[model samples]
Target: MLVRIVKMSFEPSKIEEFLANFETVKTKIRSFEGCNFLELYRDQNNTNIFFTYSYWNAEEDLENYRHSELFKSVWSKTKPLFNAKPEAWSVDKIASLK
Candidate 1:
């Protein structure tokens, strides 16, 4: 499995609009091929900052989604709300004792 996290900082006034757009397409995203699970988060101390934590089948799977039209439309709407460049990370899972 692959783990991905993205941190985005949004303009104060644009957060709500950004969230609205995300809501519109979130269902489609959650059902996309290769997706395992997905979630969203907001920084408690930094109200304008948000993050998305997701699991994918593989790096290429996530890449396919990134290059899809669904991503294009969602990103185009979300990008305009940014206060700074978004950051993302991809990681491989490690074995657990359980």
Candidate 2:
């Protein structure tokens, strides 16, 4: 399995707008092929800072999602709200406890 993590900082005032967009697509994203899980997380001290953790069957699956219209539109709308460039990474997991 593949694990993907994205850390992002959004403009304080646009946090809700960003989250609303996320809500629109979260289910579609989760149900996509090769997707095992999707979740959102926020910083305890900084409300505008967020992280997303997702599980995929492989990087190629995520790439397919990235190339889709849903991702394109959501990312387009969400990009303008960024306070800083987002940080993302994909890892190949060798083991899992659960």
Candidate 3:
């Protein structure tokens, strides 16, 4: 499995717009091929900061989704709301407790 984490910092004033946009696209993302899971999290101290935690069957699967029109449309709407560049990490599990 491939684990992907994306941290996004949004303009505070645009947080609501981001949230609404997320609501519209979250399902499409979750249903994408090879997607095993998807979730959203917010920073405790900074409401404008958020992270997306997702799992994919492989890097290629993730790449396919990233290149899809679904991603293009969602990102185009979401990118303008960012206050800073987004950070993304793609990792493989090393260890985990049951």
Best by TM-score: 3
Number of the top-ranking candidate, with lDDT as the measure? 3
Ranking by lDDT: 3, 1, 2
Question: On a 0 to 100 scale, what is the lDDT of residue 37 in model 2?
Answer: 98
User: Residue by residue across 2-82, what tens digits does model 3's lDDT show?
Assistant: 999999999999999999999988999999999999999999999899999999999999999999999999999999999
Model 1 agreement with the true structure over 5-92: per-residue lDDT tens digits:
9999999999999888888888899899999889999999999999999999999999999999999999989998899999999987
Candidate ordering by TM-score (highest first): 3, 1, 2
RMSD of each: 1.5, 1.2, 0.8
lDDT of every predicted structure (CA atoms)? 0.93, 0.93, 0.97
Candidate 2's residue-wise lDDT over 3-50, tens digit each?
Answer: 999999999999999999999989998998889999999999999999
lDDT of 3 at 63: 99
Q: lDDT winner between 1 and 3, please give it.
A: 3
Candidate 2: give the clashing pairs.
Answer: none
Candidate 2 error regions (>4 Å): none
lDDT of 1: 0.93
Global Cα lDDT for candidate 3: 0.97
| Model 1 per-residue lDDT at 32 | 95
